[model samples]
Target: MMHPSESCNHRKSLFNTMNRFIGAVNNMDQTVMVPSLLRDVPLDDVGDVKTVTDDTASNGSACFQQDADMYSSYVLLKSIRSVMEWGVLQGDGRGKERVGESEDDDLEKQFHFHLNGLHAVLSKLTRKANTLTNRYKEEIGCGNL
Candidate 1:
């Protein structure tokens, strides 16, 4: 029942939002450095508690956390993309007719294809996160004793 222009505008807004989300994620990716918790520790410490001098362990933990955040963002974007695709598919027939059946079908196919690609990327990211976590565990375990 929605007007064609309104539907178009809605889709455009969704696309804009998606772009913004991706941009934010990319920006975060570029600056994904883990801060050292030991930096705040005072040098005047009294007892036998040693300072964490190993930067690798802190950096590894930070990288794992960043990967986890990226994975979460990707999952959210995938859900949003799915909803947008559904909206496009369920739009009034008038818009579909105006856009031409073949064109609409092609657009849908492309959207699905891109979505599948996103899924694959997410899968790879998940595997990388798992590897990072395992590495972190090993490092921590070794460093503790």
Candidate 2:
């Protein structure tokens, strides 16, 4: 059992760590945009303003959907990583000796399992993006510009 001051300090530390994690997640959300390849679709002149045809609009929507899916998956992976990191940090504290050694081992195993799964998903997303980019290049008869 923790003394009153020790419990208070522990809570404070946890709060600070949570704040940092939330800030990191928010920063990632703000900075990560859809790949430029997805956003480089050309627009056609329609009256004074540029516009996309129905087919082009549909394609653009599909690209946006793919981008959203990738981004969400990436965010999920990051969140998991952040939580695992926080767990490691906490384990480094007095809690490590208090918490059974087996618990730490189990946590480490879970972290690795989730990390590997997320990496696989991220790899597939990268491959899909690359395939789309190559197809676009072939259709346009020009390399990525």
Candidate 3:
């Protein structure tokens, strides 16, 4: 019962929605997504999640998490390097003198690194979710809703 123009528009909209979804999925980051994605399941079950989600790669947070992790890792590395370099500049020590450097330094570094990574990963996931949700909204059509 729909007009030809209306039908064509509907098809175009559907195609756009699908293309956008695939693009979003293909562009996700994986490294950062692994941990949190594993959170809800048993350690042994992680493999299952991976297997199940593998086909629908965009259905989970892997890609976004990875991108986030990379960005966070880069930032954390930069920050640590900066703090170390700056501390050296400010102090009268030589050969990468320890500032905030201790037995727990490595642990602290990792903790902050992961935390920052998590934050970034979550942010990216959120953005992707928002985008996909918007696409769904658009596909459903405002007038229909």
Mind giving the per-residue lDDT tens digits that candidate 3 earns over 15-103? 44444433444333322233233232222212221122332234332322222323332223233334433553433233554666675
lDDT of 2 at 74: 38
- Return whichever of 1 and 2 wins on lDDT: 2
List, residue by residue over 1-145, the lDDT tens digit for candidate 2: 7899988666445344444445444444444444343344432211222232444245322222322433333334354445545653332232334444565567988877866665554444333334344444544465544
Model 1: residue 121 alpha-carbon error in angstroms? 0.3
Off by over 4 Å in 2: 1-105, 143-145
Error of 2 at 143 (Å): 5.9
Worst 10 residues of 2 by lDDT: 43-52
Residue 92 lDDT in candidate 2? 26
Which candidate's lDDT is highest? 2
RMSD versus native structure for model 2: 18.3
- Tell me how candidate 3 scores on lDDT: 0.39
Clashes of each: 0, 0, 5
TM-score, predicted candidate 3 vs. hidden true structure: 0.29
Q: Which parts of model 1 have CA positions greater than 4 angstroms off?
A: 1-105, 142-145
